[model samples]
Target: MNESKEFLKEYDDSKYKKPSATVDMIILTAVDVETKARSVPDKVLRVLLIKRKGDPLVVDITDPYKGKWALPGGFVNYYEDLDAAAIRELREETNISDVYMEQLYTWGKVYRDLRRRVISTSYMALVDSSKLNIKAGDDAEDACWFDVKITLLEEVKTQIKAGYIRKTTYELSLVNSENEIKDTVIVTKKLEGRTSKIDLEYVNNPSGLAFDHATIIFYALERLKNKVEYTDIAFSLMPEMFTLTELKKLYEVITGKVIYSRNFRDKMEKQKKMVIETDEWESGKPYKPARLFRFNPDWVEDQ
Candidate 1:
C-alpha cells in the first residue's frame, strides 16, 4: 500500500485543464449622427440588459437575477452552431424580434470563470431603438436599458478629444414612448479632480451572473469605440433627421470630445459617402433646420 501511494503521488497534474464555454454577444446599438455621418454609439453609450432568472418552475417568475438587468446572453449548447446559439439566447431571454445579427468576438479565458475555465464568443447585433418593442423572455426577470456613463469634462468638452474622465455614478434613467424604468443597481464613477485620463469607478449587480461578465461588459465598450469609426452603428439610435447640434452631441457622447463645428463638417464632406436629401424641417428653435441626409446608398458598404 505504501509503494502504490508513492507511485500515484508522482502522477503529472500539469496536463489537467478545465472544460471551455462559448459566449454569444448580444450587441446593442443606437443611432447617433455627427454632422453628415450617422454612426452607432459605442456599446458604452447604450445597451439593453436583462436580469437572469435561473429558476425553471417559478410561476410569473420571481427570480433573484430576474430583477437585476444585464445583457441577453448565455452558455453555448453542445455541438451547437455558434450563430444558432446566439439566436436561441436572444429569442429565449430577451424576446427580441426581427433585427440584424452578426458575430462580434470570441471570449475564452481561463480565469474568466471562477468556478471553472471557460471561453465564450461574443456576437453583435444592430437594432433601431424605435423600431422594436422589446420584452423579457423566459430566463430574464426584467429587461431595461442602461446608458453607459462616460466622462466628459465640461472643460474637456471645451478642450481635448479624449481627456474627459470616464467617471461612474448611480444617477441613471431614460424615458421612451413607454414609461420610466430602473436598473438593478446604479454604477457610480467619479474622477479625482481633473486626472488626465478616465478610470472605472464601481459597478453594482445584485443578481450576479457568474464569471467575469462585468469585465466582459467593459470589453464590449472598447469594441463599440473602435467599430463606430468604420460602421454606421450609432445611427441605430437617432431619428431619421437631425440638426448639426444634435449630430455633434452624438459624437461628443461617443468620442468623448467637444468638436469645432467647421472642422467636423469639413472632415465629413470629404468622406463623400453621405447624401443630402432635399426635405427640410426645423426644430422651431432659433437656428434654421439643417439639411437632412442619409448614407450614400453605394458608399456606405465601401465606407
Candidate 2:
C-alpha cells in the first residue's frame, strides 16, 4: 500500500486531457392551443428553448450563431454531480424546477463543439406548463415554448455486400405562440448494417440550435414516443382529472400518429390500476360533458 501511494504521488496528473462536461435539458410540455372552437382547445406538444446571448464557441463579438436558440444548459461545475447540474442549469436558465427529469443520453462527437472538447449528458423532462412560472435568466437572452412538429421527408435503402444502408430524412419545425413558424431544422440519419449502428447529422438548420441540439431534440422525441407506449410517463404531462378523449389526444400528439379510439380505450381499460373514474365531468365545451378520470396514486409505485 505504501509503494502504491508513492507511485500515485509521483504520477503526473496532466498526462491526459479531459473533456469539459455539460448538461443539456429537454423540457417538454403540452399546451392548449385555441382552435376554431374557443371552449375546447387543442393540445400540442411544445419544447422550451433559450436564445443564447453570446457566442458559445468563442468570445467573438460578431458570431452569426450568437443569437441562435438552443436547449437550456451550461457547463457542469467541478464539484457538482451530473444530475444536480442538470436541475441547477434548468432552474438557472429558465426558472423551471421540480419537474420529472431523467438522464436521456450522452453526446460526444469530436466536431460537436468548435472551441473545445465537450461531452454533454442530456436530460428529458415532462411537466404541465400551466403549473410553472418561467423567466429567462443566466446567459439566456430569451426563452419561450415552441410547438414542435416533425415530418418524415424521405427514406432510402441501399444494398451492399453482406449488409445494407438505410437513410432517412426528417424536417422539424418550431412554431411560436403567435402561430408563426420560428425556425425549421432538417436532419438526415443513416443506419448501416455493416457496423450495426446508427448515426445522425444535420442537413439544414435555419433555427440555428447551438451545437448538436437538433439531433438531441429528435432523439428525445423518439424516446418519449417509445416510452409512452409501455411506461406511465404520459401521466406527467396530464392534468389531475381528464377525460378519456383528452388522454387519447395527448398520446396521439406525442406519438404524432392517429390511434384508433376503440383500441386505445380497450388498452387503457386493461390497465385498470392506472386510472380511476372520478365523479366529475368536463365543462365549458361545445358538446355534451364527458366523464372525467384521474390517475391513481396507488398505482404509481408499481409503475
Candidate 3:
C-alpha cells in the first residue's frame, strides 16, 4: 500500500484530457390532463423538463440553445458516483426522490455539447405524479411536466446474412397546454439484429433541446415501452392501490396501443400474476365501482 501511494504521488495527473461528465434524468409519470368536456379522464404519459436559464456568460453566437427546454440534469461532481449524481440531480430539479430509477445509456458523441466535450449518462425514473409535490429547482428558470406523444412516422426492414436490420423513425412531441409550450423532435432508431448493435439519431430538432437530450428521451421511451411488456416496472408509475382501468390507461399511454380490457386483466393478473386484489374499490363514479388492486412484489417475469 505504501509503494502504491508513493507511485501515485509521482504519477502525472494531466497526461490525458478528461471529458466532463453529466447526468440526465428522464423522469416520467402518468396524469389526467384537463379537457374541455366534463367526462371520464384518461391518464397520459408526461415527462419532467427544465427550462434552461439564459446565462449571459455562456450565451453567445456559438450557443443559441440557451433558453430552450431540456431534461433535468447538471454536471456531476468529480467525487460523486453516477447513480448518486442522477438521484441528486432529480431531487434538486424536481424536488423528487425515492422513485424507480435505472441507468439507460451513455452518450459521448463528439460535439454533442458545443461548449465542451461532455459525456452524459442518462437515467430513467418512474413516479406517480399524483402523490408528489413538484417544483422547479434553483438551476432552472422553470420546470414543467409536458404531455408526451410519440408517433412512428416510418419504418423499414432489410434482410441481412446474420439477421434483419430494422430502421424506424418517430416524431416525439411534448406539449404543455397551460404554459402554451410545445417542442417536437424527430429521431430514428436502427437495430441490426434481434440483439445486435443498436443506434439512435436525431433527424430533426426544431425546438433545440439542450445537448442531445431529445435522443436520450427517445431512447428512454423505447426502453420503457419494451420493459412494460415483460416487467412490472410500470407499477413505479402507479399508486399503491389502483383500479385495473387506471392501470390499463397507463399501459396504453406508455405502449401507444389500445389494449382490450379482458386481455389486459387476464394477462396482468392470471397470466403474469403481476397484481393482487385489494379490499377497496374505486368510489364516486357514475358507473359501478371497479375493484382495486396492488402490485405483487414477488411476481417475476416468466422465462
- What is the per-residue lDDT of model 3 for residues 1-303, given as tens digits with 9 covering 90 to 100? 999999999999798888999999998988875554544468888889988778634657666567778999989998999989888888888788888678889899898887888899898888777777888886778888888878777888877776777777777777886643333444333444466666677754545566778788888888999999999888888888988888998898888899999999998889998999988888887666889999998898882
- The number of the candidate with the highest lDDT is 2
Kindly give the number of clashing pairs for every candidate: 32, 0, 0
TM-score of 2: 0.89
Sliding window of 10 residues with minimal summed lDDT for model 1: 150-159
Against the hidden reference, what TM-scores do the models get?
A: 0.63, 0.89, 0.86
RMSD of each: 9.7, 3.1, 3.2
Candidate 1 residue lDDT tens string, 1-303: 999999889987779874766655555555442333333222235567776655523333223233434567777778888777778888887777566776766666555544556678777665666666668887677666555543322222233343433333332333334433332222323334455543332244333433445545554555666766676665665566755555556666666567887765654556644434447765454444567655444556464
lDDT of 2 by residue, 9-80 (tens): 999989899999999999999977777654456689999998889744555634445867889999999999
What are the Cα lDDT values of the candidates?
0.55, 0.81, 0.81
Model 3: lDDT of residue 146: 85
Question: How does residue 270 of candidate 1 score in lDDT?
Answer: 62
Residue 17 in model 1: shift from native, Å?
6.1
Which sections of candidate 1 miss by over 4 Å? 1-20, 31-44, 54-68, 151-210, 283-288, 300-303
